[model samples]
Target chain A: MENLLEVKNLCKKYIGFELKNINFSIPKGMIIGLIGENGAGKTTTIKAMLNIINKDEGEVKIFDLDLHQNEKQIKQDIAVVLDDSFLSEYLNPKSINKIMKNFYPSWDEKLYLKYLEKFNLPINKISKEFSNGMKMKLKIATALSHKPKLLILDEPTSGLDPVARNDILDIFQEFIEDGEHSILLSSHITSDLEHIADYIIFINNGEIIFKKSKDELIENFGIVRCDEKDFKSFKKNDYIKYKKNKYEYDVLVENKADFKRKYSISVIDKPTIEDIMLIYIKGEK
Target chain B: MAALKGLIIKDFQTIKSYKTTILFMIVLFTIGGFLNDDIITFIPVTMPLCFEMLAMSGFSFDNLSNSDTYIRTLPVNKKDIVKARYIYILLFTLFGSLFGLICTILVQLLKTKNIGTEILISDLSITSGAFVGIMFVQIFQIPIMYKFGAEKGRIIQLVMIIVLMLGISLATTAIMKIWGISLDNLAVMLKDYLIAVLGIMVILLYILSFVISRRIYERKEI
Candidate 1:
């Protein structure tokens, strides 16, 4: 599949934190989940890709177009939803429809109203009057109404209730069902990503820890419950990170099959995205 | 241009939401016409200054709600954002000036038997002075706001307004001394040349401010 978005050697410097040499991509017809802890440079990476924040050094290409040179054209096919609702508080959905129609050539008022109805958002109420979930829904509704080829969402589901999050995830699944649309979703909520992501890009600190297919991760990446003797039997490089508990040593390995073949152990189990993230976050490298 | 329009429309919606503040400003300036003293002189001179206050309130709302950050995510150029704000400054000043003018006319028509030519000329001068002063404030203050954001921008705005007020008076005095024009003649000169000169200056400075603001904001990390 053709890549929809690509980033290489992305670098940004702040007073206390630096986003250093980040690289990743998302293929068309795929949902790429960007998983990272707080302050892990997830939002910064997304911003750099979209040129929302200036990058010290990087090349970002969207739809095979260099981000800066073709930003407007590229943006025409792209829709973004940050955590905060960008809509002015005073504007209702109706007014927003009027305002947005002028910006996006393909803006669909019907689609917007459909999403609002689906999300149970009030059409005439000001955005500030909505609850957190409703605000997020309004942002999502706006982003989706433009018929974007790619959706770049930064922690969009953070404040949403479980039901709303599920509804949004379903919409994402439907969005990518056409095999032309793609999504780059950044979130701390791993479970949501785990449900819909085709590929997972795990970032830590300022670096990409791994970028692997979701199926590959589900089938191979795992945790092994073993004591020190059993853990020592496995080569150090076979596992990415490990933790030593009082009862047993839980080691996070890259491949369950290879470890199982080598050790012939039955304690290996599939690791959820969250489990893998926590291991990387708290475990020894 | 469409993006710029969208940004301005967003700001208009925000301005519309502040109905109470807008009403209060109208009431305050209208009440100024009731005063039978020099305070009325300051009304037209200061009414346009309130445009700065209105724009500042918009900035405050953006800052408080973090909407500026959200605006950056839109599919528009950073320069468009700056341009929209500068346009808003112009619109706000014009609207405030018009509001003040209407009030003054109402006061003149209702309270006074015959509005003398001197009073009309004085009122015209005050309004023109206010327009020029507020335009100056906007030209400098917007770029500062782009650099420092709403918090520090407020301080810079106040300081710049004071400087512009003093600068205008000083320049006027210098012109009076050098040109040997009486105060009445100076008022006529202001009435005749003020809009054309300052209007041109405002356009040039606004363009310059837009360029500077875009540079600052484009490079700024939100």
Candidate 2:
């Protein structure tokens, strides 16, 4: 299958923190979720892809073109919405319309107006006076109005109420419905990703811990809970990350069906993105 | 370019936000010129100086505030950002020079002086003063801004300008003493060279500032 975005051996280094060699790809028409903890290099990875921050070493290709060599052309099809609104806070939507009209070659004034009406955003209010949700909506509206083929959003759902977040996610779903559009959504909200992401890429300490299809992850990993004695009887290699308490032990197994048949312990539940992340991050340390 | 137009609009909007300050300075300078008639002589020199400070402050604000982060996230490149800043400086300098010329004409009409001679002097003074001051600020501030952001750059820029002015004064004094040339004689000798030489220097400095700013911006993480 052709990929919409491909990152190979991405590396970035700082004094104390290092984004070790990382790799991932998003297939065309798929919504890929980039999940990581607070300081797990989610923002840095997105920045590297956008060329907003320099990478010590690696290659990023979008639409099958080298990112640096064909940056302008690649960016023509790519839209980015960082955590903050990039629009001038003192300017209102009317003023922003005038400014954005001049900036994007494919900017749709009609679509922008439509979004403003749909979102019920005040046309004359300065962006600074906008609520956090309103500002995020405006940013998303501007990003989508340009007819981009690929959308790269970093924590776009952050600081948003559940209703607002769902509304935004619905827009993203609509954007990719045509099979010509793709998205790389980076967020720490694993539940949201679990609901929408076709593929999941988990990162930690600037490294890709796991990249796989959600179905495969769900099918392969199962949460096994049992008495401490039963957990002690299982081999170490069978479990990826496990926790032991006074009375019970909770463990994750790669092969749920086989493990349940062979082991006497109760393999009670499917592993979630959050459960997987918690075990992988805390258990490994 | 469309990007250039967007940047220009952004800069104009920023300036518009500071309208009250610009108006206050213009009125203050006009009054100062009238009160200190002997020293100011005309509004050409006075108005341009005041506007130069405004332009510098505008650029400083653009560099230091949250605006820098906003602008960087746009579709515009770092090189374009640097180019747009220089364009903004040119536009404001021209506006200031034109305003100064109009003020000079009004002052000449009010004084009932030699209108022809006064017009020529006022035009020359305004043009030269705006050009030199604008160039001086751009060349000095751009480097400082690139190295340190606007907040700290403003302080360093003031110190650097003061040092440069003093150095120029001492050098000119030494040249006059060695050559046995009076101030008036030196002015006469340099008058013709000022337009061509200083104009070239300003253009070169502007380009140099752009190159340096681009390099610094490209390396910046944000």
Candidate 3:
């Protein structure tokens, strides 16, 4: 399958923080979750891809074109929903609609108004008066109204309630239903991602720990719970991460089927993205 | 260009958003122009000043605080953003100049004074001066905003404006004393000089500002 977006050896540095060499890609028609901790360079990566922040080293290619060289064309096909409402808070939706109509070539006024109605947002109220969920929905509505081929969301559902979050996710699903559309969604809410993400990229402390398909990730990593003494006997390399109590231990193995045959341990469950991340991040340190 | 059109619409929307403030300023300037007995002469001077202030306010809105992030996030390039801002300022300044001219005409018509060559020259001068000031602000303020952001840039912009006004005042006094050049002569000279020199300067400053802003924005963590 062709990759919709490719980021190779992406690197950026700040005074106190640094994003080490990172590489990942999203296939066309796939919804990839960029899973990471609070400061795991998720925003940094998205910013670099959008050229909001310059990269120290590495390259980003979208639609097989170099990001910087073909930035204008690349951007035409892409939509981004940032964590915050970047729209002018003093302006109402009517004003924004007028402004956006001029900016996006494919801006659908009817569709935008439809979304405004669907989201139950008052068209006359200024954006500042919007609730957090309403603002997020607005952002999503604006981003999607342009008929963009790729959607890049950075923590778009962070502060939203479950219903609103699900509504947004449903919108995303509808967006990619065309089969040519793709999405790169960055979120800390692993459960949300678990339902929709086709592929997962796990990051921690500015480094990419793993990038794989969700099914593969689930199939490969399993939660093996056993006695404390049994956990002590297993080598660290055999399992990616593990948690221990006084008498019981829950370990995350890279290859659960192989580990299961070797050790007399009960495989408790499949690990979620959050569980995997917590274990791996702690284990790495 | 569609992109340019988009920017114009966006700027107009922004102006519309601050309708109350704009209306207040317009009425205030209009009334202030009328109340002065020397309304005809004062209109030329005060109108440009008001225009400069309005242009500055518009530029201020384009700073980091208002819509920079959202504009940047769109499928628009840094060059588009820079060009849009410069164009917005130019258009607004033109609007301001037209408004000033209309006010002058109103005052002249009211006073029953003929729209003579001297009045024409003065009006032209005021328009040119406003253009120069707007260009100067664009050239200086855009770069400062790229480096310092809106909050700190405002202070720097104020200092720069004060210095510029003082320099212009000193230059005018010196020229008048040495060359026997009055305000009308200077205005006429500016009307001629601005078209060539100011245009080139504006273009150069715009290019420079665009390059610098793009670099700074690219490097910015946000």
Candidate 4:
């Protein structure tokens, strides 16, 4: 199948929050980053896709098969690492290996040991004693040992140091090298996604704002910084969202080329994923 | 099957962490029984208690780690997880009963000079009863754990026990009235087949409890 995973009209409602008409798809051999703030329904979407929680309404298809009908077979090819959930904390890496062996038919002991060594994780030390970075590495190691075709990680890089984050990014980069693997990693850390993600699925307040290619976001999208007069002179339809600053207004444009062609403004700063997200959240339409 | 094996191994690892505490308690109780004749009965009771704790502690560890969410991410389904839990509890119960029986006999031989036949039979019955109690405990405890979680389940279990006791009494009286048999007459009439009947009830209860626990877990939002 062209798309490794697809979600359609996914809806989940809590007391005060709801994920409305959520939809996205992950094509093969690509990294799709789920970027959203805390309580933005990123984790909830992941949980629903994996059957961890009962979604109010939705249809999830993995490997072109219905998720509810062929769950076990579908799960054999998917691995996940949740930010705050894992196997028992009382177990060490060695014990985790023993337990994982029985769950996956393709579990590779050699690869697991290699990851433990590469990550500098002690075999016998309980996971509860590991630092946040170490714990993330251990989780990543376990997730990789199964050699799954798809890896879903929820905030795996949160609270991690830059060096550790780079190491994890490097591993994810290597993971998709074979052109058969895909990754759906959700994180508030947009900078990391900027480095490796091919597609960015931005969610705000449980609603998807956009799902655009990273190249399109970095190349076509631009921010126009101008004085009040220049901002007022421009038509409202030219900009997507605008934020008023002390001395200037920063306007987010969908097409830098079209924006530059329309306005005579010279200053069009490049926008990062975070800057785009900030404009969407903090700026007015 | 492999998923179930993985779950069982996870529980074994959790049980292993309590090694020092388990051994210490068992040894302490055994020594206490050897020193005092009155304490003998309670020593075997410790065996069933220890293993029951071992089985239940797995749920506590799972709660602390939020492993149920992790398990859902794996190839395991809710039914297999519940089945694995039941199997783990029963395996430990069997082992615990054997250990308790051996230790009780050894302690009895070491402490007293002559063992009366009647006392021996009653002692054996008590040991068997304790293991049966362990099974019944799981039948009640597993579904509660699956529904409310390991922490809140303890309080719920207490409430369930009281309700269950009241239910059993009312059920027994109703049953006697419907059959037109007094308690004394029924006991005398069923004495020969009491063990077999009880065994069947135990098996049926476990099956029914497993179904209930699985249903509760399948709908639970981890």
Tell me the TM-score of chain B in each candidate.
0.81, 0.83, 0.74, 0.88
The digit string of per-residue lDDT tens for model 2 on B1-222 reads 788788878767756666787788666666665556653454666666666666666555554345665565566777887788777767787787777766655565566555687557756766676667667677877767767877788799889888988998999899899989999997898899877777788788778878887888788776
Q: DockQ, in order, for the candidates?
A: 0.58, 0.44, 0.47, 0.83
DockQ of 3: 0.47
Interface RMSD of each: 1.6, 2.6, 2.5, 0.8
Once fitted onto the true fold, the runs of candidate 1 whose alpha carbons sit more than 4 angstroms away are B31-42, B113-122, B163-199
Q: Report the C-alpha lDDT of model 4 over B1-222, residue by residue, as the tens digit.
A: 889998888888878788897778667767888998777887567687787877787889999988889989999888999999999988877777777777777788777867788878877887887877778777888899889998999799889988988998899999999989999998998898877787788889999999999999988877
Ten residues in a row with the worst lDDT in model 3 chain A? A83-92
Which residue ranges in model 4 land beyond 4 Å of their true spot? Answer: B112-121, B166-187
lDDT of 4: 0.89
Better-scoring candidate (DockQ), 2 or 4: 4
Q: Please tell me which predicted candidate would have the highest TM-score against the true structure.
A: 4
Candidate 2, residue B2: CA error in Å? 1.7
The model with the greatest lDDT is: 4
- Give the local distance difference test score of model 3: 0.79
Q: Cα deviation of B96 in candidate 1 (Å)?
A: 0.7
Q: State the lDDT of candidate 3 residue by residue for B113-217, as single tens digits.
A: 577888778777766666666666667776776677767877997898788789978987997989998888778978767578877877787778778876776
lDDT of 1 by residue, B1-222 (tens): 888888888777777777798788778767766766554666665666776678656777777677877776677888788788888878888877777766776677667768888878877767876787677777788888879888988888789878888998899899889989989887787787767888798879878888998899887888
**B174, model 3: CA deviation in Å?**
9.3
On a 0 to 100 scale, what is the lDDT of residue B159 in model 2? 94
Clashing pairs in 4: none
Worst 10 residues of 4 chain B by lDDT: B37-46
